[model samples]
Target: MRNIKMTIEYDGSRYLGWQKLGDSDKTIQGKIENILSEMTKTTSDIIGSGRTDAGTHARGQIANFKTTSNMELIAMRDHLNTYLPRDIVVKKLEEVPERFHARYNATGKQYSYYVWNTPVPSAFERTYSYHHPEQLDVTKMNEACKILTGTHDFIGFSSLKKTKKSTVRTIKEITIHKEGDLLHFTFIGDGFLYKMIRIIMGTLLEIGIGKMSPEHIDTLFESGIRSDAGMTVPAQGLFLDEVFY
Candidate 1:
């Protein structure tokens, strides 16, 4: 058996997220599996490093599957791209050891949230960015980000519906950057709970708009209550930037 790993990028504007679900739903993983099955003349299981929510995009998502075909990496990539829908593409492909598992072996993940800090509506980038007309205090946003850079119980930032036994997660790094009218929030973490990044961004944006103070971040952390944090940002603005093994 030959194990093949692939780097994928997709514009998630139309799909129902990455995982395969019911027959009525269209998904990234389902689409890829269909194409692989057609090309190789056999059903194959493709495993992704992580699942991005509906409307969330990915720049460097990683996945792996096993196949017996002696197809070259370059040929397989080109073949898959030809069959894949326009919103998704196979960026790279390589052979890997049979023991590799995409999700189980992942060490960390990096995500990026983009906000367009302007009043003008972007015709092209509207699907991929969050537009805010109000002026954002970048300094204040950065300060609030500092409060989230270490291991902590992120119960306040996670979805209240989560049933996980533990809400504790370690954030290895958080960086805020701005260029022109674009504000980028990048987060690197060992793992994340559902909607955690979006909630964190929403809370920080409140601080940027002067609705909340940077010091309130500590209060939210201490409260361990979901209501204390800001609203969850839209999934379209979030991107799974990379998955590290």
Candidate 2:
């Protein structure tokens, strides 16, 4: 069998998310796997770097699958793209070492969130960015980002009800850049829990508008209660930027 690595991009507006579910076929993984199964005439299983939530976009999502076919790499990529929906595209594909697992070998990931800071929303950007009418204090938001960086228990920032796994995650950096009416937030981290970025973004935005303080972040870390943290922002604005190995 030959191991193939793929970089995928998709507009998550209509899909149910990345993972393939038993009850539904409207998924990124399901769509790609179906095509691969038909192409190679085998049940091909793809392993992704991580799962992006429903309606969450991805620019550089990584995945891999093993197949016994001897198809050329470029032919495989072109064939997949030719048949996949216009909204989803396989950006790159290549053969890799047999033991190279996409999920297990991933070292970190980068995610970006887009926000429209102006009072009037952009008609074209409605599906790509979060619209916030209230003026945000970027300086204060950065202050909160400082507290949010580093290793910490992020159970409060996730929507998970219960898990045997540890909730601790390391956020390498958090930055907000303003370009006209758009506020771009970038996060580089070793890993993140469910809805962690959205909740953290909500908290930072609340802090920006003076509804919360930067000092409160420490309290949430200690509390480990989901309700005490900020709301889970809409999934439309979040994008899985890149996965590192």
For each candidate, what TM-score against the reference?
Answer: 0.96, 0.98
Show model 2 residue runs off by greater than 4 Å: none
Writing each residue's lDDT as its tens digit, candidate 1 over 92-152 gives 9989999999999999999999998899978877998899889999989888888888999
Model 2, span 165-231: residue lDDT tens: 9999999999999988999999999999999999999999889899999999999999999988888
User: Which parts of model 1 are misplaced by more than 4 Å?
Assistant: 160-164
**How accurate locally is residue 151 in candidate 2, as Cα lDDT from 0 to 100?**
96
Residue 238, candidate 2: how far off, in angstroms?
Answer: 0.5
Lowest lDDT 10-mer window, candidate 2? 16-25
Model 2 / residue 231 / CA error / Å: 0.8
